[model samples]
Target chain A: MASAGSMAAAPFWRAAGMTYITYSNICASLVRSCLKEPYRAESASREKVHFSVSKWAGGKPEKPNFVPE
Target chain B: MAMAALRKEGRRLVLSSNPSSFARSAVFSEESCPFGARSVSTQIVRNRMSSVKNIQKITKAMKMVAASKLRSVQTRTENSRGLWQPFTALLGDAPGVDVKKNVIIAVSSDKGLCGGINSTTVKVSKTLFKLTSGPEKETKYVVLGEKGKVQFLRDSKKSMELSVTELQKNPLNYTQVSVLADDILKNVEYDALRIVYNKFHSVVQFIPTISTILSPEVVERESESGGRLGDLDSYEIEGAETKAEVLQNLTEFQFSCMMFNAVLENACSELGARMSAMDNASRNAGDMLDRLTLTYNRTRQAAITTELSEIISGAAALSH
Candidate 1:
C-alpha cells in the first residue's frame, strides 16, 4: 500500500522538486545581486574580508600583517 | 531490522535469477576468437560509451541539485547580513593589540568534488601560521568538516586542537554553531580567534576569508576605557550588569551568529562550486562519448570492408 501510494504521488513529488529548484535559483540570484552592489563598492575601496566575528570586542588588529588583499 | 532483512532477501533473489550477469560472461568468452575480435573491440567501445552516458546523466542531475540548494543557502546568508553589520559596528576596532595564543577555526564541508573550496581555506590557514611570530605565539586549530580535518591532519597535525565532522550531515543552523561556540570557548584558551572560510562571490567565484574575534584582554586594550576613551560612554548599558560579564556573553552570542553566517556562506559556495564542477564533468563526458562512438563506427566499417575484400579475392582465385 505504501509503495503504491508513493508511486501514485510520484508526479506530484517531481513537480514539487522542480518548483523548489526554480524558486531557490530565483531567490539565489536576487540575493546575489543585492549583495553584489554593496560588495562592489566596498571592494573598490577595501579588500574583501570573508571572516565574521563580533565587533563588540575591539575589532580587527590595527595593522593586519597577513591581509590577503 | 525488518527493513534490512527484507532488502537482503530481495538482493539475494535478484542475484540468483539475474540472466544478464550470466550473459555478460558468456559474451566475453565467445568474443575472444580471432574472427570475432574486431566485433568484440567494437562492443567494448560501445559498452564504455554507454557507461559514460550513464555518468553524464548522474553529473547532470547533481548539477541541478546543487543549483537548487545554492539559492536557499544564499538567501539565508543574505538575510543574516543585516544583523551582522550593526553588531560589528558596535564592537569597533582594537589597535596595537597583541596575542598570547591564537586559535584558527577552519570551516569547510564533508563533501568533496566541489572544486577548490576546501583547499583554499587550508591554504589561508597556512598563510596565517606564517605571519604570526613571538615568544608566546601559540597557534591551534578547531576544524569543522571532515575535509578540513583531513587536510590539517596531513599538513599540521601538531596544531590541530579539535575537529567536528558530523555537522555537515544536515543543513547548517544556529543551534549547531551555538554548540560549537560553547565548546570552543570552554575548552580553548586564546587571545584571538580567527575564522577561516570560503566567501561566496558568485556562482563561479569564492575567495578564502579570515576574520578575527578578540579576547577580553585584547578588547579591553582596544576599547576606549583603556586610556583612549573615544565615545565609550555614549552608549549606556541598562541594569546593574558588569561591563566585563556583559561583553563576555555578547562575545559568545556574536561568535555563534558569525559562525552560523560563515557556515551558510560556505555551504552556498560549496553548492555553487559543485554545480559548476558537475556541469564541466557532464560536458567532458559528452565529448568523450562522441569520440568513442566515432571510433566504434570506424572500427566496425574497417572490419566489414576487410571481410568484403577477402571474399572478393577468394572468389577471383577460385574462378582462375
Candidate 2:
C-alpha cells in the first residue's frame, strides 16, 4: 500500500541498486536545491563535508591540510 | 576604652573577611540582623551578586544562540515532513498494537538547559516500555542522543539495545539521518518500530509524540484487519515479483524518512525549550540582583549609622 506503485515498475533508484541511504540522500539534495536563495545557500553550506588530509614524505610526516568540500 | 577595643576588633574582622568569596556570603536575613559579622559578610554578598550577573550573561547569550539556530532548524523540519507524511498517508500509521518484537527509538537532544524535552521523551518511552512489556511481549530501547541515554541507562539499562549519541554535533539532514537509520535497521529487527520525539508546537509548548512504522507483514495484517490502509485496493504493484518486496523497500525508506523528520523536529523543540528556559533564567537572575542590591545598600546604611553613633559616643565621653 506504499505510494508510487502505479508509476514506474520500480522506484528506479532501487532498480539501479542504490542503497536506501543513497536514494534518500538524492531525494533530500533535490529538495534542498528547490529552496529559496539564502536558505538554499545556508543548507548547501551546512551539508558540505570537510576533511583533514595529510601526506607523509620520505622521512617525517608532512603538515596536515584541511580539505574543503 | 573597652568599646574602642571592640570597634578595632570589628574593623579587623571585616578586613579579614574574603571580599570575593560567595560560599561565605551571609544570607539576607543574617545581614539585616543587628548582630554578628554583618559588615564582614557584605563583601561576600558582593561576590554572590557578581556570580549571579555572570550566570545571567551566559543564559542570555545561550538564548540568543538558540533563537538564531531555531529559524533554520524549523525550516528544515517543515520541509522534511513532506518526506514521511506521504508514507503515513499511504501505508496508514500503526496505532497501539501489541507486538512480539517492538523497537522503540526515542529521540533526544545531547545538550541540557532545554526544559522538559529530554525528560518528556524519556517519560513517554518509560510509559511505552511499561505498557508493551509482558510475558510474550518484548520492548527494546534504541535511544538516540546522549541526554536520553544517560537517563535510560540509570534504571532501564538492561532493556536498552542500542544508543547513538553525539549525532547533534553534526548538521542534521536526510543524508546523515539515513545512515543512522540504516545503522539502526542493520542492528535491530522489529515487527513494529515506534519513534518517540518532541513535537514542536510553539515557542513555549511541545508535545512528546510517538509515531509507529509497522513491518510489511504487519501492514498487510493491519490492512486486512480493517485498518486505515483500505486504500491499498486502489494501488498496483509491479517490477517486484511480490507485494512483499515493494513493501519491504518502502518500509525501510519510510523508516529513514520518519527518523530524519524526528531528529529535525526534536532539534527544533529543543531550541524552543532552551530559548524559553534561558529567558526564565535571565529574568530570575534580574530579580535576585534586585534583592541582593537592596540588602547590600541596607548593609552599607547600617555600617554608616554605627560609625556615626560611635563618633558621637566618643565625643560625649571626652566632654564628660
Candidate 3:
C-alpha cells in the first residue's frame, strides 16, 4: 500500500513541474521577441521602398514664372 | 513639562511667564495649532510623496501598454508594404511632370505627452512646404490631428484647406483611411498629394518622412516615357477607355493603401515615443519620492531633538 501511494504521488509532482517549466518557456520567448533585433530586422527589410518626390522630379524644378492660382 | 501635556491634547501651550517662548511656539503651530512646524511640513511632504507615487504608477502602466501596442502596429505596417510597392514601381522616375497645385497631408496624433513624435512631423511638413512650394505652386494643407492643426494654424492658417481632428483617439484601421481618402478625392483638387509622417526606426528613434502620391497627370507623363512605356506595354488592354477607367480605380486604391501604411507607421512611432517618455517620467517621479522621503526623516529627527531638549529643560527648572 505504501509503494502504491508513493508511485501515484510521483507522477503528480512531475506533472506540476512540467507545467511550471512550460509557463516559464512561454514567458521567456515573449520577452526575447519584444526586446531583441532579429524580429525587427525581418520587418524592417519588408519596409524598404524608395518613394521620394525629389527623385521623381529628377532634381529641383527651375524658377518657373510665378502663376498664382 | 507642565505645558507639554496640554500641547499634545490639541490645545495651544501658552506660557504666560515666558512671553518670548509663547511667541516662538505660537509662530510654529499657527495653522496646525496642536502640531508643531516639523510635523506639519512632514504631513505636507508625505501628501506630495503619495501623489507622486500615484503618478509613477500611471506612467509605468502607460509604458507597458505602449510597448504591447508597438508590436502590433509594426506588424501591420510590415504587411501592408506589399500593397503599395507595385503602385510606386509603376510610377517610377516621373519626368516632365510639372505640378501646378500641391496638397500636403500632415499625419500626426492628437495626444501630446508622447515626446517629439508630433512635432517632428509638423517640422518636416513645414520644411517640405518651404522647399517645394512657391508663390506660384498653390500649395494647400490637409492637417490631421489637433496637434498638427494647431501648429499649422499658428503659421500657415491661409494655406490650411481642411483639418481633421480626433482621428487618433483609437487604433487606426484601413476603413478610416478609405473614408478619409474618399473625402479628399471629393473635396480637394491637386496635381500631387504629399504625405508627411513619422517613421519608427526603433524603440528610441523615429524619423520624420515625406512621400508623394503622384496625380494622374504625373502617371500619364511616366507612362509616356519610352522605358516606362515599354514596361506598361507588357499589360494587354482591350480599349483605351477601359484602361483609363481601370487606372483611375487603381489610383484611388493606391491612395488609400498609402494612407493606411502612413497611419500605421505614425501610430507605431507614437507608441514607441510614449513608452520612452513614460519610462523617463516614472524615473523622475521615483527620484522625487526618494528626496521627499529623506526630507521627511530629517524633519522628524529635528522635531524629536527639540522636544527632548524642551522636556529636559522644563524638568530642570522644576527641580531648581
On lDDT, the leading prediction is 2
Error at B178, model 1, angstroms? 1.3
Instruction: Compute each candidate's TM-score over C-alphas.
Output: 0.70, 0.77, 0.67
Highest DockQ, which number? 2
User: Which sections of candidate 1 miss by over 4 Å?
Assistant: A1-69, B1-40, B93-97, B224-231
What are the per-residue Cα lDDT tens digits for candidate 3 across B1-320?
A: 52233223212111134333433343344336354433344555566567667767777888899999889888887787776788778755332345878888999887765888888888988887777677677777877777877787677877776666656544565555655665566557887788889877888988887767776656666577656644765687643334454465556667777887888888888889989988877776676667666766766787788889999999999999
Clashes found in each candidate (C-alpha, N, C closer than 3 A): 2, 0, 0
**Residue lDDT tens for model 1, B50-139:** 766776776788889999988888988888666556557877533234577888889988887687899999988888876654676887
Clashing pairs for model 2 are none
- lDDT tens readout by residue for model 2, B195-309: 9999887878898899899887887777777757766756886554467666777888899889989999999999999899888777766766777787788778878898899
- Model 3: per-residue Cα lDDT at residue B226: 59
Residue B56 CA displacement from its true place in model 3, Å: 0.9
> Positional deviation of B279 in candidate 1, in angstroms?
0.7
C-alpha DockQ of every model: 0.02, 0.09, 0.01
lDDT of 3 by residue, A30-50 (tens): 555565577766434332222
